[model samples]
Target: MSYKWLKFFIMWLPVIVVGLWEYVRHVFLLPFISMELGNFLAPALVFLITLTLTRGLFAKLEQMQEALQRERLSKASFQQREQLARELHDGISQSLFLLSVKLDRLEHTELNDEARETTEQIRKTVKHVYEDVRQSIANLQSPAVVVDDSWLNAIHSAASDLLQNSGVHVQLDWQLPEGVLTNKQMVELQAIIREALMNVRKYAQATEVQVICHQLDDDGNFDCEIRDNGVGAESSEIEAKDRYGIRMMKDRAEQMDWSFYITSAKGEGTRIRIMSGGDKNE
Candidate 1:
């Protein structure tokens, strides 16, 4: 029921109940009841009536509260996923485009005549991965403002989305002051970090991840690190099937003049680091 109607009914209920009770008492009970008894009995009837009506009103209020709470939670969850989708589009989607270009170059230029069939196979795989990412971005995006206006908040949203859904825990050490990285750098770095996290999810088999960003001018380096405590793999395993994600990250880092490194040992987890060997603030 609408609150307006319910409130109006409540406002008039006490008056109607009191009038009816008074009429009945005067016509039917006035003869048998003493004056003192009638006076005492009047309060008891009003109390009972008020209690019954207010009890229902309070119950309705509780129901409304619960529904409101549920809606807020549902909206919050959708917004979080929406934010991740945007991040994927901004970071991974662009990197995939780069990967396709590199694959095209390799298919046409780098392969020997004997390797044509194998190169064609890898080309088909790359095409499939590229299309899958595009489809995901389309299906995942919503018209909601999923991210705040800050780059760090974008990073936070990415981390939150991953942590909320997976068994991985994140520890963030943000040391770069706001506005230090150019917008291009921010986009590249965001995508790089995102790809690193996905690798951890798909292959790292880790329980914890730490993202560390700093401007260590000891040798004028801008560095970001993603570390995980998970089942690590040998370098050969890292180069095995579906290593395109890592290559995309590396290409993105190089595009921004940042050096990307992935170091791992069996049973020792993995560390992915990106460094710009120039001005730390730049």
Candidate 2:
């Protein structure tokens, strides 16, 4: 039965039962039962009937409501993914395709040796970006289910991909529960880590990198860090060279209200940290 109808029945059942008991007592049982006994039995009988009728119904209704909520969340997630896919396909993907075509034309045109080499390098980078964009679109178009280890695997995979040929040693420490993070947290955290890893691969000149994420306490607060044992630069220099990537990461952190900061010195390695201040919902 629908919850509304069930609730209505439960609410009025006691009153109806009491009224019927009073009618039967006055009409037929007046000689058999006293007013005192009828009054006491009426409440007892009503309680038993209500308990019998509504025992498991409440639990069932709770389960049904929970299932409905999950379905709504799933639909919202799917819609967001669809919108993102459209944006990438219509905007970044098209732009990358045009850039690739221009690079191909430049490859065919006559050029000096140095210019040709530079063009080839730029072409390779653009090709990589285009491939990444295509892969993202494909993923967005596909059905996605976030399993327990999915986000963890994503972080590991990103690190492995970027540092595979760079000869950098990687250490990963993840201790937070799988379900502790919200979807926005997962996305923003992964993006920040990927950006930091890319910087390490391209400019850190580091031999070792460590990625760590764990709960701060029994509370829901969490801490995530990306540290590299590389030739770090001063704050000003880092801001000058890595402004775009760092700014993007900062913006993402701000969107989620997470704390994000970078610490580095000329000789010391660079460390990027993002902390959740016990707030998990977006």
Candidate 3:
């Protein structure tokens, strides 16, 4: 019923018919022109040919199986990302935006100097949180357009959108070698860059941002670096919060089988880098 079985049957049919014809000639004909050595070699040669053909077919089948497995994993990951994006946009992100607005109103109320300063701080913190939420949502959502050959273009587009929306000045330096990525790989890489840029817009109030994309080691691997000039984290404790933005970024990197690194200090600014070397064929 299956193509594999059909192919197997077809491959053996020639040997089967040849053997049957030889048997009829030996049994019914008066003089058989078949030598005993030829008779022995005929089956052996058929067996060797069948083995070779089947081995090649099996190898092709294994490749097909691997491709199917990758497709299934990709589909599952995409669905999960989509669901999380919706939840963040409609549930968490909207709530944070509303909370920021409320905090702003509270900050304007008459209060003592200390109280006003505290209120302003709260407002600023909430606004930052809101931005983080929106960025997280964007990172989880699928790209605005279907990705084709140019993953670098998708990364650039996502970075530009984040900078424009957040009013961050960005400098892009991209040098991606041609044909380094397939369509699927490009999609996943685009998602990683999107998350990285979102983190930049939310946490890095940096006046200037730099993004670098290039091939690594001629191994068909690519890496991205996003640096911001804003004040960085004061301590590791500052990033220890159970927040969605950083968590999503890490999750995306893991899903793509990529390596991600973040570096920051109190006044030194922040840098986020992602590298995908092993799983380039995804």
Candidate 4:
């Protein structure tokens, strides 16, 4: 039965049983039973019937209600995913297509050495943009937000996929509490971390990479940092070589109103930190 029907029946069961008992007592049982005794038995009988029927019915009702709640949540998640996928397809995907066309036209006309180098750089940037957009669209279409630790798993999966054969020893130091980030925040952070790790895999040449996530304070603030002990670049070189990926990460953090910082020196290493505040438990 439906939860509503089961609930209604449970609610009115006592009244229904009592009414029937009273009618029977007045019509027939009056010869053998006193009015006071029937009145006393009526309550006991109602209580017994309610206790017998409602126990299993209440349990079933609870299960049905929980199932309904889960179904609603699933539909909401699906709707959110569809909206995001549509936005990405209409905005970034279309822009990338136009940029790719322009890059192809630019590739056809090769002249001076410097201009050729710049064109090549633009081509690389376009390639990265296309790849990133495709990844974002895929993530939107099939998000793994059902489990509480799905975001963490995604971070680990990204790290594994990128650095598996690169001889980089990656470490994940995840210490954030469960349900600390909203779905949007989690998606943003996952993308940022994946990008940071991809940068490390491509350019860092470091033997050790650390991905750390931790709570900053009691006010629901947290920090996520990606550090690598590799041949770090100078500020100018960082801007030139990894600008596209870095810019994308920065834009993501900015969209969420989070603080993003990058620290890299000649030989020390590189560290990218993203910090955000407020309770994002959703």
User: What is the C-alpha RMSD, rounded to one decimal, of candidate 4?
Assistant: 6.9
Cα deviation at 57, candidate 1, in Å, is 61
| lDDT winner | 4
Predicted model with the maximum TM-score: 2
- Better structure of 1 and 2 per lDDT: 2
Regarding TM-score, does 1 or 4 come out ahead?
4
Higher-ranked by TM-score: 3 or 4? 4
lDDT of 4 at 210: 93
lDDT of 1 by residue, 1-282 (tens): 666666766777777877887888789988988778877777787787678767778888998896677557547755776888889878987887887787778876766776888777877776777765764574345322222245577677767766776778889998886546655576578778877877777678788999999986755457889999999989998877668888888889888878778889999999888989844343
Better of 2 and 3 by lDDT: 2
Between candidates 2 and 4, the lDDT winner: 4
TM-score (C-alpha, index-matched) for candidate 4: 0.58
Model 1 CA deviation exceeding 4 Å by range: 1-149, 218-221, 278-282
- Looking at model 2, the pairs that clash are none
Writing each residue's lDDT as its tens digit, candidate 3 over 14-131 gives 6785787577657874274557755775677677667766777777788778767756766776688898888888888888778877877876787899998888788777777776
Clashing pairs for model 3 are 206-230
Which lDDT value does model 1 have at 4?
67
Q: Which ten contiguous residues of candidate 3 have the minimum total lDDT?
A: 142-151
Error of 1 at 267 (Å): 0.6
- Over 4 Å off in model 3, which ranges? 1-34, 104-117, 143-156, 162-195, 199-282
Candidate 4, pairs of clashing residues: none
Better of 2 and 3 by TM-score: 2
The Cα local distance difference test for each model comes to 0.75, 0.80, 0.71, 0.81
Q: What is the lDDT of residue 162 in candidate 4?
A: 63
